[model samples]
Target: MESIVMLSGNVKYTITLDPSVWIFDDRRQDLHTYFHEQQEEKDTLEEYTKEVSKHWDREIIEGAVVPPTLKTEKKYLKEELLTGTFCIPFKPFLTNAEVSENAKNLVIETVDGMVTIPLTVAEKMVLGFSKDGKPLREDGPIHCYYGDGSNYENPIKNVVSFKIE
Candidate 1:
């Protein structure tokens, strides 16, 4: 099917990925901003401590106020889903397929040709399924991108399947 990509080869399970539903996934990333933006890593422990301290202080001062308005949150999310460009990490689907321990490479089957990369690196790949608020049906069920955004402009197109070797 145009919306599915099969993940097979040296794996415990053969899985089918449907990019069409990824728009609803919480983990989907904005494709437009992903390549242009630089993210700063924060200390996880410190961030957690600060958030907990803030929550404790708020609860102590206000005695457990009602939660934030879901109506507003839902509105914003709905707008984004309708107009925002998006992508999802390829790693999750690949991990779900459970690559066999002996597998060392990931061979991407594209419309152009087969492109091979070390499985270690492929594990971090991001898949661009939509662009400019539209599914990339012309050349994709997905376009494979290097995790670091190196090939964002020229992503591997027409991803038919992923073969682990």
Candidate 2:
């Protein structure tokens, strides 16, 4: 006879946003159109729009921290070093809201509540690495930003963390 035991643990991640990370722009309308074109039901559309609108004018930042894809790492180091990549998708919003003309005094929110940092913090976070990092394949976090981008800057700060279930 044999006996086996299984145990599992859950972890919660708190992502902090830099103050400089302000919303640069919004594309809610586009998102709404996409859903409508997809033939989504009214309730579905309303729910999607409402949920996404809450974070309207927010920025969506996606990044991946992963190891090198090449096998050359084995020859050089005993352990593989992790690398990261960051990017701002063209369409990051999911509602229909007009763009903002003012970029000052913008609030940046994340999973860990609101925080402030540099405008270029996100870009600085993922610099010096390839943007081809695969979070899904590498078991990394996929961050989404929702805020105004009127005063958005290049290379948004990276102040978020991921928790996988």
Candidate 3:
């Protein structure tokens, strides 16, 4: 089952899993902490400014001091499906029996959390698993596209092509 897959958009290309290839450290920080901290700081600053303004005769600057905008940081895991050593294309159809047998091995970790590879990719890689359920191959060229999740003018334009080798 040798096939070629191509993709575009946000993607990372790596032939194999190398510890050096991991861009982020394995530290999981609470995403909400940063936001809450910023909010608290902003509130404290506003209160202090208001108190200080009362002592001055001039109308203190109003609304000019903007709290730092809280931007969500993208969390990178130790293993990400797109960043993993293996690349599998999306498969749309599988029989009940095939799904039952292969679905267990299709789960992959993403930045958003765990996601399963499409049925077709799972089927192709069914025989590629090892005794411990890990893939035997260390390198696979798979293309993936992380779309914006918006409706595209031509939906197929975002289609990724991959070949099973």
Segments in model 1 whose C-alpha atoms lie over 4 Å from true places: 36-69
Per-model TM-score, in order, reads 0.79, 0.21, 0.17
> For candidate 1, what is the TM-score?
0.79
Shift of residue 126 alpha carbon in model 2, Å: 8.2
Error of 1 at 160 (Å): 1.0
Pick the lDDT winner. Answer: 1
Clashing pairs in 1: none
Where in model 3 is the C-alpha error above 4 Å? 1-105, 122-165
In model 3, residue pairs whose N, Cα or C atoms come closer than 3 Å (at least 3 residues apart or on different chains), thus clashing, are: 3-163, 3-164, 4-162, 4-163, 5-161, 5-162, 5-163, 6-161, 91-120
User: What is the total number of backbone clashes in candidate 3?
Assistant: 9
What is the per-residue lDDT of model 1 for residues 18-133, given as tens digits with 9 covering 90 to 100?
88999988778898887677844457689889999988998898778756775799899888888888988777777788888889999999888899999878977888888777
Q: For residues 52-155, could you state the per-residue lDDT of candidate 2 as single tens digits?
A: 86545342332233336435666543221122233233221201122133321223333345444333332122211122332222211223333233222332
lDDT of 3 by residue, 70-153 (tens): 122223332342233322212322231223432334344322344445544444321111112233233322223222212222
- lDDT of the candidates, in the order given: 0.85, 0.28, 0.29
